[model samples]
Each structure stands twice: as structure tokens, then as C-alpha cells.
Target: MSDQLVMIIDGMPHTGWKEASIARSIERGPHNFSLQLSEIWNTEKQVNRRAIEQGMSLQAYLNDDLFMSGYINELAPSYDANNHTISIRGSSRLGDLVDCSTTGKAFAGQSLLQISQSLCAPFGITVHVDASAKKAANQIFNKSKRLDLGEPIWEFLEELARVRAVLLTSNANGDLIITRAGTGYADVALALGQNIKTASGNFSGRELFSQYTVSGQQSNEPSVKLESVDTVLPIATVNGSGRYRPFAVAADDDMDVAGCKTRAEWQRNVNQGRSESVVYTVTGWRQTPDGRIWAPNERVIVSDPYQGLLNAERLIVETRLMLNERGRNTELRVMPKNAFDLIPEVESAASEGFIR
Candidate 1:
């Protein structure tokens, strides 16, 4: 048999072995073949690889591949209708995952956390689950019977501990949603589906992990350029006057003379620059006597650089989760906080395209 005979061991497939060392899809000789893994392997527990092989599909098997070969990473590249998720490539989030697992488990890596990277590393990958399908797969796996030949599905399920996925979903209208999905069932689903093919690449965490620094390719970029300045109204004056007036060319030199919008803006720009925005509103702006404007008491409610993106992630994850639980009956509505105002021009539901 050719050493390249692709075989499914447990739930994942391997490209055979040479010199007793398993060959990486990417590093296997000069043939130039590579492995693409699935996004479902991160949070799920494991058992015997052989058991997963009988029923698992090529994609899940790929998940197993990247995992065994040390390549699995966070959930495969995902997107929303607007097309954006979290930019957690180099964030401490992955470190936090490692921290949590190490603290709780007995061994250094009792979870069998496999990793692979020629570049930046990652922690976890969340997925969207199909509730009904998972339930069915679970029932099927639990039964002490066989399919085609006589192998117990539970043996496979036993190898796969129950798991939940961090998934992304969308409404009928195409608004993205987010949340958790079932796992052992995800394993079953993969067994049925073909390999997850990507023109970009396959779903391998090791491959994904190396993406950030692959060939000196900078993963982080300035997609949106935003600038902010801040200033606070002084509570006291040099000469001791609480009732201060705006800077007058002829009168008070009291203003910081920062030649800026507000003291806060000056501090932000000159002090701690590069802060990203989020959902909170910054207020406390005042107009100067010279018609200049300034904001003093305004600060972000959510200062996380990635908070804006994470908000979108949370929404999509929850939405997927709801649909997985409710199926076709699942209905999602993204009512903007100011929805009524956004469409004030439309006076009726009929005018807004409602069937009623």
C-alpha cells in the first residue's frame, strides 16, 4: 500500500506515516500537500481516535488531523452579514484559556490541548451547533447497535465527551447572531458531511495559528482610522475664581492654550493614544466663548480595544444558539435601540414592507 494512503484513525484522517514519524500535510516531503482542519475541535473532549474513524467525515477527521499533528486553533475563520468577528489573534484571551485549563486540571495539559504554528498562537475556537441533529446523533451513538457492520456508536461517543460550541447564526433577514452548540452531535454531523473545503484554506488550527506571522505578514492592520481628544473644565482658577469664562483674546489666558478641542482630547492625543471605540456614549462637551468646543467628563464605558468587534461576535453567537435550539421555529429580531427613529419616515408597517 502506498504510504500516502489517507486513513481515518479515530474521527480524524492521516496521510500515513514514514520512518515511524507521522507526516504533516504541509511538511510531508516535496509533494506539497497541506492539511486544513475544522473549527469544531477546540473545546470538545476526546477519547480513542480509532472510534471516531468509523463514522466521522473528512472534515471532523481533518479536525482530528490538525489536532494530532499539532495544528488546531480557534474556531475557523467566521464572518457576519456585515462580515466581521473578533480580532483575537494576539490577544491574552488564548492565554486565559490556557490559564483556566491548567489551573483546574491535574496535569499541565490534561485536556490534550494540541497546537501547531509557524507564527502567532491561539487558544480556542467556538462553533454553532444544530440542536435537533445533535440530539438524534446522541441517541444514535448511545444505542448499543451497529450500522452496516456491527460497531456500537456509543463507543465513538464515549471517545467524544459531550461539548458545547461557540457558534455564529443569522436570522431570515440575514442579521448575524451568536451562541453555543452541541458537540458529540457535531462529531456525528461531521461524519456525515464531506471535508470543509476552502479556496482560502482548510480548517486547521496549526495552519490558522501560523497565519498571524506567516512569512512576516502582519495580521493586525488599521482598518478604521479614528481620532479622539478630551478636556475637562477646571474646577479652580489660578487667581481662585470658580466662575470661569471661555478664553477671550483680550481677557482670560486661563485656557490651557493647548491649541486643541478640549483638555481631554489633548490628554488623549498627547497622553494615551491609540484607544478604540465601543458602545458607550461620551458626553460633557461644552461650547467656548470663542465658539470652540470641549468635552471634559466624557470617557468610554467599554474601553476594550476589541469591544466593538466582540459586541458583534456576542450577538451572532447568541443568534446561532437560539436557532439551534428552536430550529425552523426560531425567529430572531435585531431591533435597534432607535429602530423607531431610524425609520421615522415610514409611518406604517405596510410601508416598511411588512405583510400585514
Candidate 2:
């Protein structure tokens, strides 16, 4: 493989970038990329100010393999004593959903996919329902759904997604993808003193708790209330540890007892999964042997004795593909597969036996 980073903007291929960075994360909202060009070393041959503008579509590839697609949102040009540089920055198509507000229109008896399609269509974004989220997509909201004026589109969608126990992400084609965690496995592995150039582990217990209690509101019926309790509030709890470290939160929206329990379990599992993380910096953007591009939401086997990880399988939560004077490197952040899964059933079902 050539391992060259090529970016296409407005149907034109551009290369020889002095520096480039593309960061993506399943936990984050959108994938973003930055490119820097300078005239100091005649690296500005591909610089086309007219073609690089806000809202211009862009695609990035590695070894001619597509990885990122989005629009350019930033353009900066600077001149120093001996160099003239241009910096370009942008995010995946989902960034529009994150930055813009909803239409304040109410929805009734609509499914998740329907709502997503309606909202995203205005921005030229398409909705892709992954098999993992098919059930969630088909789930219909029977009640009257109202959106507050000026409410951010992504925030509203995230609330709906949380209720369904699924996630909203974007693919290389810049289309919104409804999916679950750990959807696939990487073709290669990362091990200490092997493919990984540097490794670091972060183990913290600050966000974790021994117990999580999720509370939510039900109906306003007097029959639902207890002895003198004016209103009825559904509450569910999940244990995290033996200690008394308890954390409580309110539901994102109105839900049932089962939903509350799922929310609590999600909080506990995500915290426990995030409590420990391993970050690895590899030499190139692709796997050493298989040549597959490093991507988020994929599980990979990790064998690093320093972090007590012995051929353990973990989810790739985030990745940063970087190319600078030092050369191309990929930084991967992995955590427990269950961190992003909402319910235990989902987590258990997605788990596969360790890779050989």
C-alpha cells in the first residue's frame, strides 16, 4: 500500500500536505479533519483558495481507501517571515446536525428512522439504519413529541437515541448511521513490543460509583401515587460495586420502569468500562499485517503485559490519524466493549470469543 494521505475537495484531489490530522471517536459527535499547507518547502502546489471554502464537500483517503467525507468549515491563511501557510479544518456531515437547531415541529406516532430522515433531509444528510439498530429504528413514539424552538438537532436526536439504547454516528459516506457498539472486529492486533510503538493506560475511578439510581416521572394520576406522595416517580437502581458510592440521575425523558432500569445499568456499565482505558500509538494508519484501516467502533485484541491486558479484546473507542514531519501514525483509544452498550443483553450478545 502506498500509505499516502490524499484529500479530495470539490471533486479535486489534493496531496503533499505538510501536516494533517483526522480524529474520530464513537463517543464523540462527529469526525473532524485538519490540513496544513505551506509555501516554505513548495508544499502549496495543491493549495486552491477558490475551491476550499465553507460548505465545500471533502473526502480523505489513505492508500486510495476512503476514510472520511464531510464539508470544509474553516479556512485560515497565515504568513510569517519566510513561510505562507493555509490551514483547513472541517468535520463530518453530522457536524451540521450538531451545530444547527431543530425546526420546532412536533411529531406524533413517528418512528426513530422517520424522525431522523425528516430532520436530516433538510441538511442533505441521509439516514442509514444498521442491523444492530433496526429494532430501535422501527420503534414508534406513540405519544405527542414536541421539540423546543432553537433546540440543537443532535441533542434532541441523542435524547431519543438514548431512550432506544442506540447511538447516532456517521459513516465514510457522510450519512448518519444508527448503530450499536462493537459492531465489528479489527483484522489485526496490537501488542506491546510488537506493532504498537507506544502504549499508555489510564485507570481511574472518579466517574464510577458503587450504585446508580435512575429516577423518572410517570403519569399524574392519583392512583399511581403512594401514601401521601403527591406524584408517582419511577425509580430503578443498579449496583456497581460493594462500596456505598452511589450516584443518582434523572431520566432524559419520560420512560417506564424498565427504561429507568436500563438507564441505570447503562450508567454503571459505561462508567465501569470507561474507568480503565488503553491508548496505543502505531506506526501507520493501517493494521501492520492485514492492511485494514484503523476505525472506531471495532473490537481489537490487545496483548500488553504492562497494562495487565493479556490477549484481551477491547473496543476501539477513538482514533487519531496524524501525519507530520515525523511521518504517519495512528493513535487508538480502546476501552471495554460494554462501555457504550446500554443493556447487559446487548453487551453479552455482541461479545465474541477472544481472537487467536
Candidate 3:
């Protein structure tokens, strides 16, 4: 059976169509898809409109394997004297979590799994936390004057993931998944003159700080200070005095010197990696050597002399796939594998609730 792309709307599978594309972008949030069909070519225009109005479910599959499943969230039909077509767009079940809000609720001393399950239960979504991930109790409120939980459920969960240095994403089956950031690596390598059609690398230290000093101040007391430095690049080589980045944390019921320090260190590492990133546009959907589909949060070796990178394995942070009249292609945004990986010392302390 050859590879095929199809979209099912209201229980009807559509393979032969004018155009279709699925974009799974974990870094920017929920994955989404779009389909465009001509009115004269089929009856999808009418069926799609009815589905959109009635909020019918939609699912997409590649090679009969489910890739994305969600409800039809948008519909735009067009018609003229010489043309007739309809456009449909939708997002995964994670979109519902982003739309749902939690009000007048407080979650204290609850594990990440518990919080995620509680928030996603109302939307009929399942939560799956990686076994290797640390489950720590956190505090969140929806009605407190000091802490308002008026934001969407996804936003709340994202904040929780950020503090713990984990990643919150959805699988192709639309299950909410929480895992370590940049932990998955593919065996295939993306090499120039092999599969990569174009490549570019960017490096800059303008936003990076060689030294970070984090201070936590309590009521009428001297502030407790913690410092972290970017050891990847020496201060003497870059600047003698060292570029200082100061972070002040207001002491709260949950704030502590240790938590403040953890935040400072995580921020420093993130910024340092962000200072240098790469983007590669490849020829097809999968790596040439293994035919593995390109996905986010996976590491792949990139070899390109033009970009000054030779067989450097980087983390695939984002991926964009397009299949239309222009043909099929994939674009990848990558960064150092250690970009989001926390320092061993910081990771251990943060997992122990030393970080908020």
C-alpha cells in the first residue's frame, strides 16, 4: 500500500481532492489543518458547510494511520461567475482546552497529572504524562485576589510545564501529552545534498547574559541572593566584566530564594540557546535515509557546509508541511539539543519543588 493522505469529515473519507494540508506545530501550540475543495469537483462544499454549522467531527489520516483528529471549527465558502470552492480549517482537541476557562477554583498540593486531568475532564480529553517526568504538587487559584485563574486551561497548564521545564503537547490521536522538552531524537540525519533543499543558521549573543543574579526579598529583611552564570561561553572571552542580568523576585506565599534561582538559571539557559538557532527547508515529508516523518521535539543531525554546520545534531523545535498545487515540502526550525535541557543540578532541585 503506497502512502496516501486523506481527511475524514462527518464520517466521510476524502482522499482525491483539490488541496489538503496538516500542520503539527507543537512549539506554537495546538496543531491544525486546512482543506480546500472545488464545488464543481465534488459535493464537499455543501457537506462541509452543513458539518461546520452542526459542528461535525473531522479527522485526518496518512497511509490510513490517524494523524490528526478534531472538530470542524471554521468554514468559508466562495462562489463567482467562473469559480466555486470552499475552505475548511480546524484544530485538535487541545484547542478546546485553550478555549475552556477555570473560574473560582483553587488547586493546591495537587500533582501535575491531577491538575491536568481535572482541567481536561470537562472537555472529554485524556491527559498522559511521561513516566520519566517528575510529578510535583503545585499551587494555582482561580478566584484569589492575588492569583486569578481567569486564563484558559491550556495557559494554566503551560505555566505549570514551564516552571517544571517540561513540554505540554498533543499526540496525533489528540491526547494531551506532557514530556521532557527536547528528549526525543530520531535516528535519521538531515544532510545537505541528500534531502535538504535549503538551509540557514543564525547566531547572536545580544540577548544572552554571561551572569545572572537573582534576588528574593521578603518583608523588612535583607534580600536573599542567588547567582548563575552561562558557563558555555567564558566571560573573559566575551566581555571582561561579564554581561550581567539581574532578576528580582517579590517574596510571596510560594516564593523562595531557591525557586527564584531556578527560574533565573532556566531563563539564562533558554536565552543562551535562543541566541543561536537554525532553519532548514527539506524536499519532502520524511528523512531520506529512513523515510521517517519530520516531527517537533525530535533531534536530527544536520549537515550543511553553506550554513557552517557539519553533521551537527539539533533539536527540531518546529515543523511546517505543505502539500498543494505547488507540491509537497517541509520546513524545519531547529536549535541545539541542550537548548531546553536543564542543568543537572538545577533539574534535580527544580523537580523537588525548589522552583515554582
Candidate 4:
């Protein structure tokens, strides 16, 4: 603890709170938290239905570091003849994006940056694009539309991010960020015998399709067929070895045979890379040695023999932090760097358990 944990409710800092936890993600989703307070003798510190009705805003800080800022979305109070406590659950500013529905908008030739800026303007968020983002600032959206059925702005933006191999996240100051996946972040090494408390590794080939056949069909054009196979070294010798698993795809529009082949190959490589994953639980909120905060999208070095991993560099795809009266801990979900380059899956088989 850096002696700077502060929880502000409606701009007023309150002390003596218990059992607080905040969760943030790089998936362009909402960050949320749960807080508990004792109401035994503090009449002025009680949170009740009135607070919920008034839409109480919340801001949290850890030693000069902004942890969470949002509004109270849910409130629950529990009282017994012997004990008294009030618990509140809420989300961050991203909640506004998740709840607001958009009425079918068309961006015939607008760049992704322009579209994101326009969409996030209503929420009072500034959108920042990384210099290394795949799509240029002026690149036009050839054809994109929000359906008439209406959907959350966050959901719509998430779809675009997926297709473009980009990530959307918010900074400590509550500004929106659009950047390429796994880029623009520093790598932190997590030594097994040092700061890491517990770790587990899991690898699966159940859904690994060793072969893919793609067929591209265009209006008034001949159908073209292409095949892609998994032969990327190390991975080829392990989970994908001797497995002739086959999958197929039907590409729409004017995709030629070469394009289909490239797409299939890319998909095969990504799936192969994602088959293996590692989960690490560290003691502190930040990585040891450097004291930098652990965040998603950054790279980390793992050296643990119990998991059969040694001096391996991996990408941090997800991170979860838990803070309470006891202590603070961080959990990280990591995968091979290649996993970040694959195209997002739009659909998948109902049953992926069978190897064939």
C-alpha cells in the first residue's frame, strides 16, 4: 500500500470503507467495481436507496494513481440483527457507451478515427489513435453501417476494432484510445521465484484445425478454392502434430483464390498460436524490479518450470486486479504474440470439443 487509497462518492472523499474491488479490461468494455461500507455507528456514511436514486458519482485513487471513476449503477444493503453493512456495485463512464443505442448511421467514406471521434463525442470522451494503428487516420470506411435495429455504441465500435485488429481502452484520465493490438506498450518480465505467487499453463488442440479449405465466390465469377495448412515450426511439432483436423470457409464478395488462400493461412496460424495460454497471479499490483503497473496488451517474460515454460516471452491479453482489506493481487492472462495478429472470429462451430 502506497498510503494513497481514496474513494470519493459524489466528490466527497470517504474513509473507513471495507471490501473494495475494481476490475478493468482492454476489451473496450466497461470497468466496474464493488464497494462495501459498515453502517453500524456512522449515520452520515450510510449509502441507501436515496443515494442510488440521486445517481451518485464515484472516483477512486491509489497513491496518486486514478484507479476507477464512474457512477453508482447498483446498490444493495444487507442488515441483520447482529451485523450491519451496505454494499454497492457500479460501472465506469463506459457504461454510458454500453447503454446508449445508436440509430443506424452510415459512414460511406469516413475514416475510422473520424467515426470513433463522432461516436464518442456525445459521451464527452476524446478519442486518441496510436501512431502505429493499422488503418490510417484518413483511410475511408468503404462501406459500414449501424443497423436500423439499433445497438450500443460500444458494441458497434468493438465490432470495428475486431475487424481492424485494434484495441479500444480508456486511460486513467477517462479518455478513449484506439490502438493496434499488442503495440505501443513496454514489456515487463515476471520471474517465477520472485514476485509471481502462482501460475498455471494450459494448452489445447481440441479445436485446432490443422487444415483449412477456403472457397471464394463472386457474383458472375468462377468460384475459386484454396487450402491452408499448419506447419509453423515448434507449434507444428506439438499440439498440431499428426492431427489432420480440417476446417472450411466460404468467402463472400470479390475475393480471389490468392486472397482466400492468404486469409485461410492467416486464420490457421492464429488459431494455432492461441491454442496455448498461461494464467499468472502475482503478489503486487505492479511487476517486480521495475514497479510498473501490470496492464493488458503488454508483453511479459515468464520463467517457470512447473508449467514447462522457460524464458518465454508472451503477450498479456487480459488482467484482473483484486483489492481488499487483506491485500492486493493481480492476475494476468497471456498468450503467444502471434495470437494478437489474427483476424477476429465472427462465428464458430457449435461444438468445438471434438478434435476432428
The TM-score values for the models, in the order shown, are 0.14, 0.82, 0.77, 0.82
Provide backbone clash counts, one per model.
36, 0, 0, 1
Q: Flag clash pairs in model 2.
A: none
What TM-score does candidate 2 get on C-alpha atoms? 0.82
Which pairs in model 3 have colliding backbones?
none
Q: Write the per-residue lDDT of candidate 2 for residues 156-236, one digit (tens) a residue.
A: 787677657787888887889988986688988888888889988887767766556777666632111111111211011
Candidate 4: 10-residue stretch with minimal lDDT: 347-356
When 2 and 4 are scored with lDDT, the better candidate is 2
User: Which lDDT value does model 1 have at 84?
Assistant: 24
- Residues 1-356, model 4: lDDT tens digits: 45445777887776556677677766546677787776553345543322332268878776566766778888777675445676888777777888888666666566667878888898787788777674554465555544334667787777666555577776655667777556544445767887678887777776566567766664443333333344353454465456666678776434666666667777776776688788888876766433566777777777888876688777787777666765777788888777667453322221111112
lDDT of each: 0.20, 0.76, 0.65, 0.66
Q: State the local distance difference test value for candidate 2.
A: 0.76
Ranking of models by TM-score: 4, 2, 3, 1
lDDT per residue, candidate 1, 6-30, as tens digits?
4343344554221111111110101
Best by lDDT: 2
Q: What lDDT tens digits, residue by residue, belong to model 3 across residues 206-324?
A: 66554555454434332444444444543223444454645454433343566566656666667666766888887666654335667888888778777667987778888876677
